[model samples]
Target: MRRSVAVRLSALLATGALAAATGMALSTSTASAATGGVTGYATQNGGTTGGAGGQTVRATTGTAIHQALCGRASSSTPIIIQVEGTINHGNTAKVSGSSCNTAAGVIELKQISNVTIVGVGNGAVFDQLGIHIRESRNIIIQNVTVRNVKKSGSPTSNGGDAIGMESGVRNVWVDHATLEASGGESEGYDGLFDMKDNTQYVTLSYSILRNSGRGGLIGSSESDTSNGYVTFHHNLYQNIDSRTPLLRGGVSHIYNNHYKNLNESGINSRAGARAKVDNNYFEDSKDVLGTFYTDAAGYWQVSGNVFDNVTWSSRSGDNNPAGPNPTSNTSVSVPYAYTLDAANCVPSVVSQTAGANKGLKVSDGSCTPQSPDPTDPGPTDPGPTDPDPTDPPTGTNLSLGAGADGSSKASGTSYGNVIDGSTSTYWSPSGSTGSVSVKWGSATKVSKINIRQASGSGTVNSYRVVNQDTGAVLASGSGTGVISFSATSLKKITFEITGASGTPRIAEFETYAS
Candidate 1:
């Protein structure tokens, strides 16, 4: 049987289109200090015990969010800012102690310590804006969506990052949020979440990153290797071309995450970076774990990873592929205690728990006491609930090539590979562009076409679907995804590859009747 495409694709699109605590009894001030010997990933970190113990404030505008951060009674006091509406940053004034350098255009959380910015109600969205954190500590950002942050034009924020942090930052937990962009640096967009300049002790848990060219990075440059000790778990990365985290020089723990359609590269560990990769799922991607294009090499300790329908490049001097079987050069010892979900459970676990509005179902690594409700008007927070894992509306695959015949412009690859139902095999055209057509024994009704890429690297930038017998075009598009149209009876259908990045490698081209 065809691998259950509908269930996986639905979960992927639904997520692609759209923590805490603990420890000890020292004095209040001594207990909250960054050097308080706080052990867990989040307990002795940002904003937990900063201000007047647990004050929840609400903000709807960007200005209000700034004021809440600036208006804190003291830098060490902890406070929560519940954001309800869209926060289009309009403020650009530099707060003196907070070290905000940029002019008023982005939400600047500078210099302030101990703050939590969370979304409530319909959830908060930062549209065409960015959040900059510099010289800050003890921060938590949860349940928010950030999109379309630009760099070149006017009103740009954090050099186009949806969330950017640097310089003296510590103890930050970014959970259950969505960060996205339409294109890459050429389109005035940059990374989704970035950390650099001595930042440390951070955890990015249960988040979604989609349609972004750059996912994120740690340690901005080769010489800047001080930033390290970060954790990434249970996140969903979809349709992102590259940098499913380009780690420069850090000790990063990457576990239980799901990566799909990473066209160019993924998990670039270079510049002496050391990553402990365990129990992660990589599907339909290319060169998922390796050091590419750069001479500076990074190392990894990989275990229990599932690379399904993935392809790897040749091992040149600089291009080092991590696996058909990955080996560990160095061992990493994680400071805190945590649990690991199996790689197979990552897609479902991450899809249900990863982004905002799904309730905060995080593991308590330290099992510390809970703080008072962080946000006001206290929106109902639901526990993690599994979604129905069924394929979307689909019919029998009529183009399975069982009794059918097909032909392609390229001859080396068998045209029947596209209908073979197996993802492990594929048909690669001799050149970058070509066409493939299938003829049924009789007229068949077709409504949808699912194109699965075996390598997931060859780009079908534009394409056209035509009914060969009637000489009529059925569908045309730019970019790759499931293509659906009104059901039409046809004896022959041709899929013409109009544009692409490399030699086309199609794993499966399944046609269905509605």
Candidate 2:
């Protein structure tokens, strides 16, 4: 019941031959107001327009008002489609420029609401979807930047998660945009932006998720008490992999931010979702193999952070159980873990060369023990079956010195504090002969030691730890020879000085676990 075609231009005040048809009817009926808020009416020759009074019905060609607002638009009367420039592949929009490979989501806002598709200037890269909001609610997609959303081919399980809110589309917000490398082939493809379906208050703040194929941020809800509320603050998650295992889900909050080179597992809590990984700085990544459960991933809680050179591997479960189980022992987990404020934060190893990896050793501090310790019932508290002469007193040994052979040393003076050298060899100057020679090759469990400054070159001055069956001394420090001990049973493990009192040589001997 509303119709009006105000083409009443008073004839351009006809003074000179009708002033050129009223200056082309004042340049096509003056309506002009487009930069998202949309308003552009211009009709001349066929002059009889009307949807009428609330004049929005104008067309230059965005597919004829997208088929006159398909399905008559509801969800509180939301039907605003404003697109200025660039929907590449070769340019085309609103169905046909390939209607998104014959259509799946070019603009599938099915059950729409306060649907706002604003983009003026730098916007539009719907190689697939610049907007897909299905079963929509108060949906708001701000400052848009979504390029190459490729997929119309190759898809097996997990074929890239660019924007799949597959389940039920709920309160979603994707702000300040830039979603690059729009994943499509597999490995979960790329960052599926802000997905929802079993939804809740979801917010992805200030975004710029690059190389989006295997992960920048992702969430899911299969139901382990499915109450999903994800918040990834001040964003930027770079080069993720294994197709991307970050942000698996469990009521999330991943703060501050900057994660580069993440091949896998930066943060992937699942099923029982309560993932709160704070502060944030996960550098040069790789090796978070899998497991931080919910739908049964791994009970989570990892705080305050700074993981430089991060690498942690643990993912084994299956009970054929007849022998050992310290809590499923996937060879004990590492790269880092914490407690802080309440006390218990250890991580400062990185001395290299101990590659078969069983982890945990530093028998005492400011490290220096390429391999030494094994005297018999030595590290005290002997009770349970008594064999502890450095190690071999228990199970789980990962063999180092446990591969046995002798000629070790350490000293101050007991005929001359010894570590004769030989048995494991190769430190040469003659096995670097004694002022205090310490080298033994088969005693396990030396709970944590770190004497840095030897990566390519070297540096470590004054170091001490002796017992080699009692030439005693036990602990000494000088300069950067950092220290800590308590796993005694030595035959030889010695280092006295090098570089950095002047800096030219090398020194780095590390071990951990108790």
Candidate 3:
């Protein structure tokens, strides 16, 4: 019965950390329009004074003038608001019928310090949340473009999440934002950036998390042992081929990102959190990478990553292994350069990072410690970038058992993995007691069974799912909660219970049919 480790709902609702007292409460700019510099500042209730038509500030209405023009003043005070038409919750036209979108304000700041939220001209776009910060300090969320629309009859139904920062917020910074296609109910549970818990010194650079069902910068939180120091660099979690379902939280520091056509599992660090990956790049993805078991005290140091036709599944009995150690240390270096479309050849250089290019430094040495001059951009390379089709990367697939009708389509050897008929899939029970059969070959007609009980860190509360020809008893839950089953055609589905008996380990197995 484990399932309690997901804190940082923005610092359990902020109390201290920020306003340590500084100086200069600057606020300039009267009014000027030419397509470049626009500014204005004023935060009455929270008391902030900043002015300047250049640094940036333009909020046209409400949220007490965007908290009197980006409040908090010991430094940082650049605002740019021009949100027109529709506003606040209930979706707000998902970014005002496009013009680049904009509508919704209230970017709070406690401990009051550094603030810079930009998005002028064709810059700001938010049908919902483009930015939302708390307990702020040294903040800077630039080039915004949030699009949390909603209204999807299925297609894996996703909603909510463009940008969200929770309690204990510290040294935050997000650049080049462009979060897209969230789910229904106004895209609430989805994520582009839903960094939770006592977020500390965060930085989601060069952003672009497209059409998310989940997966794209999720620090997660329900509240436990909070201490997030995130830094998901050079972002670009590409097209996301299909299988729209996401869950993985805790620990931070995933480096040099770039994944294309990624289906599921790119970078998940659950169980106890403590990640430190390097030089990333996974293409055509199926399962790029992960470190589960709720990641307790989990340690990682992967290097120079680049797997073109990426496909790898870890977690056998547990203690999932990747390296002896090489994510960082001794000058820092993580390397990668690809060529595996099916071995197209002509792209090699791999290093995990440690002393002068320690492990996996390939380049023809077959990989022994050779990667050093593929152009040299290690020690955290945020240079030489490309991949922005105007922020294009979207795919949502969800399909479960019993011949999922409604224009059914399920293949991959009929669900050994990778299923998506648009999403509404649910299944649990990996404690392993033994039972696995759910085959509705030729038309059996099934009606609904959705369960959810795998919440936070090596999660599990209680488990059970049975319908072997009417043995019925189709529901029983705990912890990460969700159970349902009305009508049943029972194609073939079985899961009997294994570890929750003692708790902790339940590596894989999830079910869903509606």
Per-prediction TM-score: 0.62, 0.23, 0.23
Residue 245 in candidate 2, Cα distance off native in Å: 4.7
Could you give candidate 3's per-residue lDDT for residues 280-315 as a string of tens digits?
Answer: 666776655554334343445565666777656555
Q: lDDT of model 3 at residue 88?
A: 40
Model 2 Cα displacement at 288 (Å)? 4.0
Q: Rank the candidates by lDDT, best first.
A: 1, 3, 2
lDDT of 1 at 284: 97
Per-residue lDDT value at 111 in model 3: 41
Tell me the spans in candidate 1 whose CA falls farther than 4 Å from its real position: 1-40, 43-52, 90-103, 362-514
Selected candidate, larger lDDT, 1 vs 3: 1
Candidate 2 root-mean-square deviation in Å: 31.8
* Residue-by-residue lDDT tens digits, candidate 2, 307-424: 6677665434511111111122121122122212110111222121111110101112232312112221111111111111133223222223322222332221121211111222
lDDT tens per residue, model 1, 1-514: 1110110000000111110010000111111111011223544343233322334444667765665555555665676665667777553243333423334678887776777676654568998889988998877787799999999775687799999999989888787889989888888899998999998888788889988889999988888888878888878999998888998897899998999999989999999999999989999999999887789999999888999999988898888878667788778888677777778777877876678755444322222211111121111211111111133337677767643234443565677877888877777666776677767878888777777777654876546566666434455433344555546677777676755788677777777776
User: Which candidate's lDDT is highest?
Assistant: 1
List residue ranges in candidate 2 displaced over 4 A: 1-125, 134-190, 196-210, 213-267, 274-285, 289-514
